[model samples]
Target: MLKDFKAFIMRGNVVDMAVGVVIGASFGGIVKSLVDDVLMPPIGLLLGRVDFSNLYLILREGTAPGPYAALAEAKKAGAVTLNLGLFANTVINFIIVALAIFLVVRAVNRLQAMQKSKEPEAAPSTRECPFCASTISIKAVRCPQCTSALAE
Candidate 1:
């Protein structure tokens, strides 16, 4: 059982998948940071200096007070709230990641297509006999079975 488990773990595909998962997780973090720190700030500024991360709706008042400045403050005060800003940031992050993945896939497909185009087409190995309607070698000038002269 241990040997079987080891074999499964040692497989090339499993190892590659593990590596991909780790890299994808790292990429997700990068995309999250880009959305939160880079993109959202400028967009929020353009919308009259509104802080997107603080944009939320208070469902119910907290123990502290009716008004909570930020999502963190609301949560800290035990208030039921809808974090719209956070949701927006997450959606942006997902879009960036999806686009990146799409571009990578498109590039890989193009490279494969180019490689296929570069490869030489295989020469024909066989031909049909004109007289007998039978398969024969391409090099044959006459049909062996039918004994008929074949055109070049």
Candidate 2:
């Protein structure tokens, strides 16, 4: 049972899956950072300086007064809030990751197609006899039908 378990864990597919999971998690973090730090700021600036991360709805008022400065402050003050900005950022991150994966898969498929196209095709080994118009193997020394000596 221990040997079987070791074999299962060491299988190529299992190892590949484990590596893929780890890389995918790291890639997700990168995509998230790209969306939050790189893309959103410029987009927000173009859209009249609207900060996506700050866009939220206050369900319940904070302890002090009307408007809470930030989401953290609102949460700290025990205010119920809908963090729409963070949700938007997450959605963007997903889109970026999905697009990147799509591009990678597309490139892999193209490479596979090119490889298939470059493969050599099998050539026909039989030829028609000029005398009898019968098909004969190229290796035949004599025509079986007409008894003619074939040229080497």
User: For model 2, what is the C-alpha lDDT against the true structure?
Assistant: 0.91
Residue 40 accuracy (lDDT) in model 2:
92
Q: Write the per-residue lDDT of candidate 2 for residues 42-119, one digit (tens) a residue.
A: 999999998899889998887866588788888888888999999999888888898999999999999999999999
- Model 2: lowest-lDDT 10 consecutive positions: 61-70
On lDDT, the candidate that comes out on top is: 1
Q: In each prediction, how many residue pairs overlap at the backbone (N, C-alpha, C within less than 3 A)?
A: 0, 0
Model 2 residue pairs with clashes: none
Q: Mind giving the per-residue lDDT tens digits that candidate 1 earns over 69-142?
A: 77899999999998899999989998999999999999999999999999999999999998899999999998
Which portions of model 2 miss their true places by more than 4 Å? 62-64, 121-152
Best by TM-score: 1
